[model samples]
Every structure is written in C-alpha cells, then in structure tokens.
Target chain A: MELFIDITLLTFLCITALAITVIRKLFCAVMLAGIFSLLSACLFVSMDAVDVAFTEAAVGTGIATVLMLAALNLSHSREKCPPYQPLLALLVVCTTGAVLVYGTMDLPAFGDATAPIHHHVAPRYIEQSQQEIGPPNFVTSILASYRGYDTLAETVVIFTAGLSVVALLGIRDRRGGQSITTDRSAMKGYLVLRVVTKLLLPFIFLFALYVQFHGDYGPGGGFQAGVIFASGVIIHSLTLGRDRTLKAFPQRFLTILATAGVLLYGGTGLAAMVRGGNFLDYSVLGATALAGQHLGIFLVELGVGVTVFASMTLMYYAFSYRKEA
Target chain B: MDSIPMNVSGHFNYWVAIFLMMTGFYVVISRGNLIKKLIGLNLFSTSVFILYISLGKIHGATAPIASETFHLYSNPLPHVLILTAIVVGVATTAVGLALTARIYEQYGTIEEDEIRIKDESL
Candidate 1:
C-alpha cells in the first residue's frame, strides 16, 4: 500500500515538474510550484519524516508561494521564450542524469533496514536519545543537543539572507519618504476575507506557540513554528495592508529581533561555557544534566523561532515595499 | 543479468529522484527569465531533499519519535539535516528573488539575453 502511494505521488510530482518547465505564464508556474511542494510534503509524511514534512509544508508551500507571488506582482508574470533552442543545456542535463542514475545503482533498496545510514551513528540517536536528551522526538534531540553548532550556523545563514534582502530592497523609511497609509478603501470590499483572517490570526499564533513548545514531544520545532508564525503575519499583511502590519511590527523592530535571535542562541552557548561546560554543552547547565538540556534546547529553539519569524517577515516587507519604478 | 528486474524494481525511488533532479537542472539552464530560473533552482534543491529523505526510510518503521508501542523508527539523522536544508533552501530562494527584483528594477527586464544586450549597449 505504501509503495502504491509512493509511486502515485512520484508520478504526480514528475508531471508537475514537467508542466512547470513547459508553462509560459509565470503565474501558473508559481502555482504549480506550490502544488509540487505540497506533494513533496505528503511524500515526506509517507517516508516517516514527519518533522521534515511539516517544515516543507509550511515553508515550501506557504511562505515560498507568497514570496514568489509578491515578486511576480512587482515584475512580469509571463516568461519570454528563449531565442534559441536549449540543445546544449538539454545535453548537459541528460549526461548528468545518466551519471546520477549510474551512481544510484550501488545504493541499497528503499526501506532496507540494514542500509549503511541506519547503522553508522543513526542507531545511537534512535536508541539513546530518549534517555540522553529527554525528547521523544529524536530529530529535536539530535538537532538541538547533539548537533547544536550546525543549527546555530543555519540560524546565522537565515539572518544573513534577511540582511541581503534588506540591503537589496530598502524597507521604506517612514520618516523620510511618503508615509505608507493603510488604504482602508481598497480593503473595504474584502470584508469577508478581512473578518475571517482577523478571527483566525489569534488561533494561528496559538498554534505556532504550540508547535514551538511541543516540538520535543512531536514532529515540530523552531523552524516550522517560526514559518507558521510568519505565515500568519503575512496573511495579516495581505488582508489588512502592509502599513497596518508595519505599525504592529516595525522594520527596525524586526531587524533587531532577527539579530537578537542569533544573540540569544550564542548567549545560551556562552552561559553554558561560563558554567564550565564546553560551548553548547547543555549537560552542565542546570542542577541536573537533564534539566539543563531541556533548558538549553528551549532557549535555543526560542532563538531560532524568533530569528526565523523576524527574518521571514522582514523579507516579505522588503519585497512588497514598492519603489518608484 | 538475472537480477536486472530486481535491481530496477528495488531502486525505483532513486530513479524518480534522478529524473526530478535532471528536470530541474534542465529548467535552470534552459530558461531565460530570472524568476523561472529561480523556480528551477528551487525544484532542484527540493529534489535533493527527496533523495536524502528516501535514503533514510525504513520499512514498517514509524517516525523517529520515541513511542512505547513501536520499536522501529526511520533514521532521524536525515530528517534533521533536511529540516535545516529546507529552511536554508527558502533563505537562498529569498536572496535569489531579491537579486532578481533588483535586476528587474535596474535593467527593466528580467530576461537574461535582454539584460546582456542592455549591458552591451551601455
């Protein structure tokens, strides 16, 4: 049954990719990309990577679609056909695909228990994480405790991306330029969407909090939660207008929040170091090793959540803020 | 020679992944539009994520959450790596789109050939 489902989904994914390649209208291509992400998320669920599936669904399908649409709105929606046939590109792609296929011939069959990946190091995480890290979700334990440094670097990467977007598209300085006004008249006709979104905003926030805190027990963590929170803010901005949303979360505030998230993560490591533990070694953090691990993971996850939420919102602001063209 | 059918059937997932990877690669190199190129890059990265996740699957194993009722779990390592990768993927995409937006603003067209022509004229 799982194989059947997997085959079906992969077939659909192939069709979507092919369609996106052929589609001339960039709007339709963007929509197809959303469908592609959604299908991949479903595939992740079937493959037993629930946490990955959740993150892909929220980040890939939700935020990415919005960002692409905003970019499309700013620019052109139709793709100009290339002047020449892409024969050389097609030849390169075919050669690469053949090489990759040859490389995969040596790989173990799908779902084989004795595959090399399941043996080296993975077994330790699977069998010992519950006792060592106290998180039922092994992905969280491994992500937050076992490999804390990588997660920290990933957070910095996100922060850097946010900075790049801000640098490229300056967030309209309210003081110097024409102050952005909430066009209430423009949104008056969206009465149903406005009211529904207003009602759903609180619950969305509550769910994001739930995902953040409950990450240890289930298939969620800071990345997914932060994306979820940002999606809520994006929806609000879309419905209520960017100016109103900016009033609630100013550009400066978001920039600081993005920086502060990285600081908080690093600070947690520093605190651990001061306690005579190695940097990011949370075992030496609190009264007991387990307690300290929980506290450390909580703090760092909070940091990730804050940075991702801020960065995503900041990028949205940067993209949506149109200048005189 | 006798194992040819077995090999093909067993590694079906990997074949699909390679196909998707090539599809994205083709789009990235062939397309002239900057936005389309970015979309192709996204498809490429997402296919790589699929490849990694497929390698981590274990037959009959549940998700890598500790449960008293289930003893078998898929490898959690790939999930951790890919979770971070997905976020990173979006970050890179955002950066690429930002650059594309800037290009559109400055050059007035996102078509690669047109931008090059404008650059030459300047």
Candidate 2:
C-alpha cells in the first residue's frame, strides 16, 4: 500500500516538472509552482521531516505563489522569447542532468542506516545533543551549537543580502513617488483578512520567540525562528494594504534590523574571544562548559534569527517596491 | 508526529524536486518575458521546498503536534523549518506581485524584449 502511494506521488512530481518545462503560459506555470510546493510538502511528510514540510507548504506554495503572481503582474502572460530552440535547451538540460546524476551515483543511499553521514559526525550529534545541550532534536543542537559557525555564516549572508537589496534597489527615496496599481476593488477579500492578520501577527511573533528559545531543547533555532518572524510581518502585508505593511515595518527600521543582526552576531564572536575561548568557541561563556555553550548559542541564535528576518523582508520589499518607479 | 508516512521505495521525491528546480532555473535564464521569469522562479522555489520537505517523513509518524497518546510523531524540526520557509515564500510572492504592478506601469508592455529595446533607445 505504502509503496504504491510513494510511486504515485513520485510520478505526480515528475509529471509536474515535465509539464512546467512545456507550459508556455506564465500564469499556469505559477499555479503549477503552488502545486509543486504542495506535492513537495507531501513528499516531506513521507520522508520524516515534518518541520521542513510545513515550511515548504507555507513558503513554497503560499508565499512563493503570491510572489510569482506579483511578478507575473509585472509582465505579459505569454513569453516574448522566440519559440524554444529545442536543440540548444535540450543539450544544456541533458548535459546538466547527466552530470548531476553521475554525481549522485557516488553518494550513499538516501537515509541508509549505515551511511557514513550517520556513522561519523551525525551520530555524535544525535546522541550527544541530548546529553550536552539537553535537546531532543539533534538537528537543532547541531545547527545552533555544534555547527554554530555555519549558522552564523548563513545569518551573515542574509544580512548581506538585505544590504544588497537596499543598495541595489532602495537607493532612491521613492516614497513620494509611490503610485497605486491596486484599487480597493482589486483587493476585495482583505477587510476581514486584515483583522485576522492583526490578531495573528502577535501570535506569530510569540511563536518565533518560542522556537528560538526552545531550539536548544527541541526542533528549530535561529534561522527557522527568523523566517517565522518575518512571516508575521508578511501576513500583515497580505491582510493590510502594501502601504500599511510598509508603514508598520518601515524601510529604515528594516535596515537597522539587518545591521543590528550582523553586529549582534559579530559581537557574540568577539565576546567569546574575550571570554578566553577561540572565536565562536562558546566554551568560555560562563562557569561550566555546558553553561557557556548554552548561553553563547542562545545569544547567537537570537542574532541569527533577527538578521535572517530582516534580510528576507528587505529582499521582498525591494523587489515589490522597485517596479513602482 | 509519527503519523506522517514514509515509503519503502527509493528517494524518488528529491530527484523530482531537483529536476523541477533545474528546469525552472533554465526558464528563468532563457525566457524574455518578465512574467515567464516569475513563473520559472516559482518552479525553482517550489522544487527546493519539495527537496526540504521530503527530508522529514518518518517510517510511521503522526503530525508534529504534541499529543498525549501519540508515540510515533514525525519530527517537529522539519515542519518548523518549513513553516519559516512558507513565510519567506509568502513575502517573496507579495514582493513579486508589487513589482509586477510596477513593471506594467513603467514599460506599458511587460515583454522583456520590448522593455530592453525601449531602454536601449533611451
């Protein structure tokens, strides 16, 4: 029974991919993207990472669809490109696919129990996180503590992305030039949705906090929490008008958030150095080694979350607002 | 929660996701229309989301919600991460929509070829 379902869903996913390539209509392609996300989430549910699945469903299907639609609204539905040069595209696709497949052949079987990934470093994380960090979710511990530097780098990347968006697109002070393409009529179902979003935003922020704090004990940490935090603001944008969303999370404040996040991260590393540990070592945060690791990780996670949220928000804002001018 | 089902077959989902992602990326690079590019972007993103979510399913797990009687709950971690990803997607969509509206205004025609020609003539 289970194998049948897997094969069927797998087939559907493949079909969607093939169909997306052939589909000429932009709108259909965007809608298919939503379908793709939904299917991916279902696949995740089949895999065992419920957390990743939930995010896929939300970000992939919901927000990405909205973004694509917005982008579509920027242009015509039909592609203006000359008809597909089948031979060229096919060659490119085939070469790329062939190379990736060849790479996969050398990889261990997905989720194989005896895979080197599970044997070497992953096992230490799986077993030790419970004992050292007191977290049931080993992935979180690894992300937040064991591989803290990587997470830090990822956070910095987001912050840098935010800065890039600001530099590239937000250079002009176009608030005065902002024009309205959407009438009240085009945004019909928003009155009630706005109220609902207003209600939910606080809870969303709260949930972000919980995820950030609880990351040491369970699933999630800075990156996930940061995304959720940004999402709360996004929901506000969707419900209320774009203008209102802008007012709530003004561009200046977003820049500050991004800067603060990077500073916080860098500051944490500096603090660790001062505490007599190597950069980001986290072993000298306080008294016991465990205590230092825990405290250091927490502070860094907060920094990471804040930075990611700001960056993601800034990117969205830059893209959305630029077409206005 | 452990209610989420896993399969005995191979990791087919990831492959599909990767394929869609690559195709979408190709479209984005090759297409001239702005909207078509957006569509391709969606394809690319959705494929990655698929890849991420496909990592979470347990052999026999329920949803991630905490329940008293549930012994085999799927790992809540992936779901949490996915939730964040979802929010990012929403934000990206909102921005994309806004940009589209602006593009329509700036260029009158949304075709990339026309926009580029207009730009070059300027």
Candidate 3:
C-alpha cells in the first residue's frame, strides 16, 4: 500500500516538473511549483517525517510562493525562448545523472531494518533521546541538543542570506529622485481582504509562538515558527501596504532582532563555557542534567526563531521596497 | 519476463527519484529564464528529499514519535536533516530571486543568453 502511494505521488511529481518546464508563462509556472511543493510535502508525510513535511509545507509552499510572486511582479511574466538548444548542458546533465544512478545502486533497499544508517548513531538518538534530552520527539532533540552546532550554523546561514538580500537590492537612502513607496492604493478597494487578513493575523502569530515553544514535543521548531510569523507579516504587507507594515515592524527593530537572536544562541554556548563545561554543553546549565538540557534548548530555540522571523521580514521588506521603487 | 534487474525492481523508488532528479537537472540547464532555473533547482532538491526519506522508512513502523507500547519507529535522522535542507532551499531561492530582480534592473532582461549578449557589447 505504501509503495502504491509512493509511486502515485512520484508520478504526480514528475508531471508537475514536466509542466513547469513546458510552461512559458511565469505565473503558471510559479503556481505549478507550489503544487509540486505540496506533493512533495505529502510524500514527506507518508514517509513519517511529519516535522520535515511541516517545514516543507510552510516554507516551500507558503513563503517561497509569496517571494516568487513578489519577484514576478517586478519582472516580465513570460519566459523568453532560448536562442538554441543546450546540447552541451544536456550532455553534462545526462552524464551526471548516470553517475548518480550508478552510485545509488549500492545503497540499501528502501527500508531495510539492518541498514547501516539505522544501526549508526541514529539508533542511539532514538533510544536515548527521551532520557537524555527530555523530548519524546527524537528529531527535535537531535536537532536542538545533539546537533546544536549544526542548527546554529543553519540559523547563521539564514541570517547571512537575509543580509545579502538587503545588501543587494535594499532601497537605501534615496541618492537622487528614486521613490521607495509602493502605491498604497493597490489594496485600497479590497475591503474583504483587509478584514479577513486582520482577523487572521493575530491567530497566525499565536500559532508561531506555539510552534516555537512546543518544538520539543511536536513537529515544529524555531525554523517553522519564524517562517509562519514572517508569512503573517507578509500577508499584512500585501493587504495593508508596505508603509503600515513597516510602522509595525520597523527596519531597525528587525535588524536588532536578527542580530540578537544569533547572539542569544551563541551566548548560551558562551555561558556554558564560562561554567567550565564544553561549548553548547547544556548539562551544566540547570541543577540537573535534563533540566539544563531543557533550559538550553528552549533558549537556543528562541534564538533560532527570532533570527528567522526578523530575517524573513527583512528580506521581504528588501524585496518589496525595491519592487516599489 | 523475469529478466528485470533485482536492483531495479527492489529499489524502484530510487530509480524514480533519479528520473525526477534528471528531469530537474535538464530543466535547470536547458532553460534560459532565471526563475525557471530556480524552479528546476527546487525540483532537484525535492527529489533528493524523497531519496533520503525513503532510505529511513521501515516496512511496518510508524513515525518516530516515541511510545512505550511500540518498538518500531522510522529513523528520525533523515527527517532532521531534511527539515534543515528545506529551510535552506527556501533561503537560497529567495536570495536567487532577489539577484534576478537586480539583474532585471541593470540589464533590462532576465534571460541568461541576453545578459551575456549585453555584457559582451560592453
């Protein structure tokens, strides 16, 4: 039954890819890409990776679609025909594909119990995470506690990416006569949009907080929460225009939040160091080892959430600000 | 009729993943539009996500949620890794789209070949 479902989903995925490639209209392509993401999220769910599916659904389908739509508004909606067929690119791709397929031949079958991956440190995480990290959700404990440094680096990567976007296209202080305000009247007549969005915004924010604080027990974490928070802000910007949104979340505040979040994560590690324990070693945090892990994970998760939310809002501001100008 | 390769039949999901991956690669390389290329890149990464998730599945197990009554749970490691990958993919996509917007501003077109043509004349 699972095999059947997997095959069906993969088939849909293939069709979506083909459609995306054949479609000349960028708008249609973007929508198709959203479908593609949704399908992949379903596949993730069926594979019992609900945490991954949740992230995919939020980031891939929600924020990415919005960002791409914003980008589409800035540029032409139609893709141009290529001057000539890319024979060399085709050859390269085919060779690379062949090599990758050949490599997968030696990999363990889809779900063999005795697979090397199942035997490795993965078993330790599954077996001991409950006792050690105090989270029934092994994925979260592994991500937040066992692999703290990797998650920290991932947060920093997001911070850096957001920073690069701002540097690249951010509307700096007008050197000449370039205007930064988008037409506020763009959403002027949509009474329904404004009302509905207003009703939903607070709930979205509340959910983001839930996802942030509930990471240890559920299928959510800082990364998912931050993206959800940003989506709410993005929706408001869409309905209420950029100026009002900026008033609510000013550039300076967001910059500070982004920086402080990363600092908080690193600071937790430093605090542990000052206590004469290894860096990011949460065992020395509270009176008991489990208590320390809980406190440390909570703090770092907060850090990750804050940085992601601020960075996302900043990136959206950067994109839309330039689009308007 | 029984001549089908064992690896091909047993690891059919892997083959499908490879096919999806190759299609994405072809689109990325063959397309001239920056946005299209980004879409293709997404497809490619998603196939990889499937590949990894499939690797961690057990025949009769449920999600990795812990329970005292059940002994079988799917491997949680891939889920952790892929969650991070999904976020990273979106971040890169946003950055790439931002760059495309800037390119449009400077060169007045988003086609790779056109950008090259414009650059060569300068």
Interface RMSD of each: 0.8, 4.9, 1.4
lDDT of model 1 at position B55: 98
Answer with 2 or 3, whichever has the higher TM-score.
3
Estimate, for each residue in A1-325, the C-alpha lDDT of model 2 and write its tens digit. 6546666777887788778767878788777767877876676666666556545644663346555654565456665554446567657866886776565554443444443433455445544655676456655565566666766765665565566545655634454655544523124566677677778888989998898888655556676777777767766665665676776788888889888877887787899899778888777887877787777777887887788788777766765665565
**Each model's lDDT:** 0.91, 0.64, 0.86
Q: What's the C-alpha lDDT at position A175 in model 3?
A: 25
RMSD of 3: 2.7
What alpha-carbon RMSD in Å does predicted model 2 have with respect to the real structure? 5.9
Report the candidate with higher DockQ, 2 versus 3: 3
Docking class of 3: medium
- What is the C-alpha lDDT profile of model 3 across A94-140, one tens digit per residue? 89878988887788877778889899888899888989989888888
Positional deviation of residue A16's Cα in model 1 after best superposition, in angstroms: 0.2
**Which lDDT tens digits does candidate 2 get at residues B1-122?**
11224322445555666677678778776666666666677667766665554454444555544335665544344444444444444544444545555667777877667777889999
DockQ of each: 0.86, 0.28, 0.72
- Show where candidate 3 strays beyond 4 Å: A172-186, B1-9
True contacts kept of each: 0.83, 0.37, 0.75
User: Which scores better on lDDT, 1 or 2?
Assistant: 1
- In candidate 3 the C-alpha lDDT for residue B81 amounts to 89
Question: Each prediction's Cα RMSD?
Answer: 1.7, 5.9, 2.7
